[model samples]
Target: MNNVDEDNALVNFEDDQADDLDTSLAVDRFRDAVLYGTDWTVRTLLQQIEQGNIDLSPDFQRRDAWSLRNKSRFIESVALQLPIPQIVLAERKEQRGTYIVLDGKQRLLTLAQFAGDFPDDHPLWDESRKVASLRLSGLRVLTDLNGKTYNDFTSLPDLAQMRTQFDNHTIRSALIRNWPDEDYLYEVFIRLNTGSVRLSPQELRQAMKPGPFTAFLSIKSAESVTIQKILGLSAPDFRMRDVDLLLRLIAFSTRLSVYRGNLKQFLDETHEFYNANWGVEQKGMEGLLKRLEDGLIFLCAAFGNERHVGRRYKGDNFESPLNRAVLDVQIASALDENVRRAVEEGRLDLLGTFQKMSINDQEFAQAVAGTTKSITAIRTRYNSWRAALEGVIGQPVQMPELPNG
Candidate 1:
């Protein structure tokens, strides 16, 4: 995580261009703009949901991020006729005019559960069933309405006014047309959420860009027993730090030299490259997955835990970057399909070689020294490990020609 210097941050800014811009200029640049509209009332949105026009199951920031207390407060906000943040959605790639919520899943979920099961006639409502009524739990402005559910408004004698207020409330929205070639919606989502420190880099990418590559990584990590054995994730770490660690292996191993030392930029570029061909390049993604799987199986066979992966600190925790840098280069250099299989299925033992290299390797030491984030450090550490891996293989391994992206 190299910090961008101050001089570099304002490099894209311009002070003299404010008056020269035109509406047509923006429209021309964003000619791929598909379904651009905003300002929908809650009633209009609900009608769309009921008519089977809206998709509530888009990959969200976090499906279960809102606690009951948070949901309760949100409901209260809507009930009070307050303006909520705009919800954004993208037209589904597979279904024309069908849309998926990009930004406001929690808000929509709370509304659906409160209003009762997406009206039962909606298409997604059956597959994505609403659980039950969510009774209001918290109230700052509407204290008297703290415990009411939507059902109570219809049947009860005293609560009719509250129902009308809730149903008539408005929430703004933005819909992006799912253009074929350009990632207009994805880029918009990234720009909108970049300032949020609440999300991790991978989490944001996974949510913003969903495809086979993302699905593959999630499934692979969930099913890997060996990975869990190697690096037990810390409790309360919901940011998918473990998955990112494995991804670090693939990204750096494949393109070690092209790495410019900024992890956010590196990962952002890598994800864009992978996501660009979501449906059209499934075969390529599968091949990449195969190489990564081979490397993972090989490494697990060679090492036991985090201690074997990186420098052990005095506090007993292992340094993750050093561990990852070493693994990335080692696996990348020897990940020729045949070599990886030989190490994994051929019962080769390189524990002694790795153990000795870990202790005596000067480049490994330099990799973690200074800021483990610079290009110099990345190259040194990865180069050192590549050499170490080659020594164990009893042959010089060739670095693969890889894309800059």
Candidate 2:
């Protein structure tokens, strides 16, 4: 959502004004005022940035394209570790109070942009900033859980001077009784975000929700932990969408198959799945999963293949009959001994048997139908079989552990 036009007030400060104003004391006093509503200080914001958890949403910063030079500036600031720019916020008198961002989008974005562990060679890297911005580069500021602690700022301890300066550096919010038009806000978001590091549509969605499911995944194709770990998550990886799919796969496979609709529906249903009989079923599945893991390790030992299979399947390993059928099935099965028996008795042959298994479930059927269009029908059918086998094993494994709250 855009809100540029909705923000009816704007404050323009020239470098001269900033240079002349003794803002330290005023900043200190205004700290309390700012804290009352936003409750964020330079310390807290920086801490979140270092933690790579700041909310760079429409409410915080606009979506925009960021050039390498812009990224370098951000990296320079991080390397210098300077205090993040002060944000001026105001409250709106709507149904519930809403906070408005008054200034500091560029500086705030610089913090949010480079906060993540971007590759070392990228222009935005902290090390690069150090090498490039030699003078300001060496100065590193300390960050707290609330705001930034600057040696330069704190060095000036004149209380009266600081107080007077803070008063002079006035930052306030303006609210409206009637809500601004949605189009105005949208335009604001776009205009502010244009020509900067713009957020994607999916990223925007994640910001709106900002919950467990939403919080779980929010990276671009350039960086997908799921692709790195999960078997078969390929390039052009659908970052959040992939995570959403995985969660759904796990949820549906666990017996919430009836409720697997959109990501939102599955997330809501997950809570109920935990409370229902499936909880016990999932536990059984987990125990079986452990057994299967042990069994796979044993199989690896038997096969003399000692390499680690990361948490999820990926690439050729994902499509491997050995992984998709035997490993996946055995892992999901609740009956360890039964699985062992099956493997010993050629039950592991289920990898090939996947082709023979009937597709009766609606969810699986639809998946097969949809996937077959892109991949071969045979491959889709096999994948469905793989999921079913894994699902069966998963149900009997110890309760499908809900993510730790």
TM-score of each: 0.57, 0.34
lDDT of 2 by residue, 64-164 (tens): 33444444444444444344344633333342444434345445555444333334543334323343221122223313211222222344564344323
Candidate with maximal TM-score: 1
Worst 10 residues of 1 by lDDT: 13-22
Runs in model 1 deviating more than 4 A are 1-28, 31-37, 50-52, 58-62, 92-96, 119-132, 178-180, 198-327, 330-382, 389-405
* Top candidate (lDDT): 1
The TM-score measured for candidate 1 stands at 0.57
Q: Per-residue lDDT of 1-405 in model 1, one digit per residue for the tens?
A: 111222321121111112111111245446656656677766677777766577554222222345678888888888788889989887766677667666776687668667743545554454335455677876788887778788887888787888888888888888877454223544454456655522234544565556666755655654555454445432212344445555666567555557654665676566666667668766765677677666666666566553354332223343442345555555664576545644666444555555566568766765655445566666666557567666666665566443342
Candidate 1 versus truth, CA RMSD in Å, comes to 9.4
Candidate 2 — worst ten consecutive residues by lDDT sum? Answer: 8-17
Against the true structure, candidate 2 reaches a TM-score of: 0.34
Q: What is the lDDT of residue 228 in candidate 2?
A: 26
